[model samples]
Target: MTSPGLPDLHRHLDGSLRPSTLARLAREAGIALPVQPRFTPGMGLDQALACFSLTLSVLKSPDAVRLVASQIAEDALAEGVTTLELRFAPQLHGGAPPAVIVDAALEGLAGRGGLILCGLYGEPPDLLSRLVAIAADRPGVVGLDLAGGPLPSHDFSMSDYEHPFAAAREAGLGCTVHAGEGRPPAEIRVAVELLGARRIGHGTTLLEDPEVVALLRHEEITVEACITSNWHVGAIADPMDHPAARWLDQGVRVTFCSDNTLLSATTAAREHELAAALPGMTPALWNRAVECGHQARFTRS
Candidate 1:
């Protein structure tokens, strides 16, 4: 909230859990962490991801989930994010029901934002159905998103396109997909055309296919670009090589985000700063990207 304007759309709840809370929960859960104490600071992509296991270890019970969910909203509000789509995989939380996380997030959010139930790439159809049910029942739950590890667990096949995404849409749930990160640009096409992805995560490779770019722009799809997280995950070797600038130049809708603030140790202000530095990026273009997030958010009410 200090510098970046009042709305950051793409933030992960699990990734933004507070350090002090994690330490306390770890102590209670008897989970050992790295010597550094802080979950952030110079970690390889796998290591940063492994930190989630530690977070998941502690965020099992409803009280734990509620506290962490509330804290995440507090941090986002502090970052000037009046509204955001906080995504997390409830199934990853030691069998905690999706309702617990969603309701807790709603309580914490206090109507400030919405929750996006994450369907991890390898999950079975039944799980996504349950997620869709939860989202459909909860008005504060905004949508469904397909996310996976550095490598996508499921290919962009018909089965992948159908299951949760189509089912969720059929049940009135919004859709977004994590594509163009570990997969090819064509997969981004599949996500949009087949799976109904209104937004894309880490869409750095989207420009690899001109046709895909046209489809994205023509559809007015929003790309959530996480510059630091992309470099940390090695999706892009250099932040300077990021296509956000080019996408903006082409009048493509793009939004900057801190994919995992807990792991990346970044804030909306920091993300805006990094986004402004993209080679050939202009201040006007970057401002438009911020506005894109503000305008593209899925607020059902």
Candidate 2:
């Protein structure tokens, strides 16, 4: 049977642009890409990450943010995506405050041809309350997330950010944290137990602990699995070996995403296609993944 349509639950708006779009933007603004475009296709995780950071250098203004956001929405529409949750750190734009960046993003989506739900990414321990306040203030903002580099030094421990995450919960904002991607299983546990995360972004390491896996299944927490990102990061030796299929087989809710589409040179459709190459995955299972995304989405008035 033909695969059902794809829905991207976890994508960074800044990371979802087509390479041609990035090149055009760079040219229009007289900004140079950090790495040559040719290097992006086969670049490793660190290199890909560097490329994304370079893109951010050019995206340091409100007009750039608006342009990227609009392009992301248009790209999603072209992909036949019915719904997509785009995440980004609002503070990435230099001069403007986080709120203004978010407002500019919303403005970018105003006349877009399709519906796209946007969420703001926050680093824990420092900006959780500010992130929550943005969600509370913006009707278009749907959820809260923790996104940053994947390293022990970059990890946001719950011990450091519990109170702020609690504040977000009190504000009725839905929570999702990037855990278990490159960190230990204990970090994943903290996200669920301490941070009260309803969804775990890149919870690949959870498979190491059956109890943790069971808890995730029992709690009905969704895992946003970015296949290409995992492969690029060396988290999994190969895209074909990623444990997303195993997690799904064990009844864990796993949704596919393009963590940094430009860096990874992929899309939600491409992710699902790669997933299908894994053992035990079928079109039916892929549809279930989409359902998991819809279920995991933060819905509040």
- Top-scoring candidate (lDDT): 1
- Candidate 2 root-mean-square deviation in Å: 3.3
- Output the lDDT of residue 226, model 1: 87
What is the model-wide C-alpha lDDT for candidate 2? 0.73
TM-score of each: 0.91, 0.88
Query: Lowest lDDT 10-mer window, candidate 2?
Result: 113-122
Give all candidates' CA lDDT scores. 0.78, 0.73
Per-candidate RMSD, Å: 2.8, 3.3
Tell me the spans in candidate 1 whose CA falls farther than 4 Å from its real position: 1-4, 36-48, 149-158
lDDT of 2 by residue, 220-292 (tens): 9999999888777767777788888789889999888877677677877788788888888877787788888
For candidate 2, what is the TM-score?
0.88
Q: Name every residue pair that clashes in candidate 2.
A: none
**In angstroms, what RMSD does candidate 1 have relative to the true structure?**
2.8
